[model samples]
Target: EEHPDNPGARLFLGLTLAQVGDLDGASREYKESARLAPDDPFPHYFHGQALHTLDRLDMAIREYREAVKLAPQDVRMRLNLGSAYYEQGIFESAIAQYREALKLNPGDAYIHYNLGLALADQGRFEPAIAAYKESARLNPTDPLVRYALGVVQETKGRVNEAIGEFEAAAQLAPTMAAAHAKLGWLYYNKNQVPQALEHFEKASRHDPDDAQTLHGLGLAKLASGKKDEGILSLKQAYQKEEREDKKRLIRSVLVKVGALSH
Candidate 1:
């Protein structure tokens, strides 16, 4: 109130409001700050952030574009714009912005990971893998990056490579249910029942409600001759699964095993 004309004060006030979950009030102050200092990019950038959080994505994009135009060299501005584009499923625009961000700061692991995600969405598996590899190289201990790399490898039909990456991710973060679940599926497919059971059990311990883990656990148990346990696990998976096709698969397996009547 004391500094109505001060753009900096308005910007700080906007940030505080946003931090306190007063997004509507924050947006108003951000707009005022931008109006007061049209040449400054921070107000627009922060406004874009607030709009992004509110999921007003198109409006967020507009503000992000304005901020980028005012500060072309700012990597963070480009990254946030890319993420907004990604969320909108505009893969081409997201990839372009991520590439530009990479040019500004090639060493940023997160930027490379974002680029990989955009490429992967477009089914550009080769380039996606390359981007993910660079991200992993830059941040080797990041389990999410390792998990992403494993997913791409799996999609490309490189099961052994996928298993290696998933294993690394699981080792890096023991409670990473997704990685363990992927490992379980891969090992199960390779006829390694014990390994499959081990990983599936680990995944279930971490994420007890995941239907996929339950399904895999059931399959591994069946393969290993644990009839009652396998049927129980399959029943649990069938009950929890939401996808029609997956539920049908579990039902068919149960029918074939004589646990469910035709």
Candidate 2:
């Protein structure tokens, strides 16, 4: 109360309130801070962050825009604004902001990764791959980046490149079920039954209830001449699958294999 007119004091109080999980109180304080220090970008930036955490994205974007206006060259402001846009599925705006951020800080690996995501979402696969490659170059050991790159490569029908990326991702994070699953599917498609089985088993160990993994395991087993085991895996996959079309597909496979009635 003694520092009622002090914007900095209100900002600190907002931070403290946020730490204590009193987001409403923090927001009120942040609002007051911004009002008191209308010319200062920090208050608006902090306010935007608080609103973003609350999932009040439209309001957050307003505050972020204000902050960006006050501090056009602040990469953090641009990045946060870009993130808000991305979460709202405003891909074009997100891409624009991310591009602006990259121009300001070209060497930022995290920004490059985010840019790749936005580009990939827009189906700009070539640019997305370029952005992901830059991010992978900047942060060589990041498994998620490798996984994302692998997914884009697979989408582009570059199976060999996808396999290499998924392999690198799996090596970096052994328990990453998605990487194992991708590797299993890729190897299965190549008729490398043993390798497919190995990866499918690893994927199943990490994500036991994944229907796609179970389906791949079933197919791999069938290809390797384990008819009964393959049929059982197919049953499990049918039971676990949530999609009607996929469940029908599994049922058809079972019926074709004489494991189910026509």
Candidate 3:
């Protein structure tokens, strides 16, 4: 308490406040620490973390840039800076930092996955697919990596490859609603109604209120000659649908089935 100018004491207090969820107090202490010890990167790094937690991403980026400048070899600092840039939708900057981090630790699957995400955000599907494939190779059992790969593959119009990845993801993580839903849609596209119905049912069971899954289930049931069940599923989907376009499609189907008037 006596040495108010002690940067170490301020830094320690900042850490304590941050741990207790007092982000505002933590920011204040961290700022004082940085001011008192301008050459120390720790205070700037911790300050960046607090700003990031508060969603002040631009300020977080500035502090992180300062910290990275002071310690260019610090992998975690580069990773956090990349993450801050990603949050701000500065995909190029995010990619640069992630690439820099990769040079420091090339085998990190999570870093590869994050790089894929940044690349994907910029609509660089081919490179994103490459990054995701590398992530999958590094983390063979990670359902999330498989799922992300499938999404990018689907975007690239590689339906069969996407189906393979989504199927693997669903098998690896049976309760993942999106994986099952994606498999169901892919099956539906292939006119494999039975297969679509199976996955759609699982998807709906996992996330009962998911309108897209319910709609797919309804369509699959209709194609398989289960008109009554299809109608019920369509009604459920309509009730939960939030998008006007989807609601309109549900209404049109209802009208065609004589469940609703023209």
Error of 2 at 161 (Å): 1.3
Cα-based TM-score, every candidate: 0.96, 0.97, 0.98
Off by over 4 Å in 3: none
Give the worst 10-residue stretch by lDDT in candidate 1: 140-149
Residues 1-262, model 2: lDDT tens digits = 8678999999999999999989889989989998899999988898899899999999999999999999999999999999999999999999999999999999999999999999999999999999999999999999999999999999999999999999999999999999999999999999899999999999999999999999999999999999999999999999999999999999999999999998
Deviating ranges (above 4 Å) for candidate 1: none
Sorting all predicted structures by lDDT, with the top scorer first, yields 1, 2, 3
lDDT of 1 at 230: 96
Among residues 3 or more apart in sequence or in different chains, the pairs in candidate 2 whose N, CA or C atoms overlap within 3 Å are none
Error of 1 at 209 (Å): 1.1
Which candidate's lDDT is highest? 1
Cα shift from native, residue 104, model 1 (Å): 1.4
**At residue 86, what lDDT does model 1 achieve?**
98
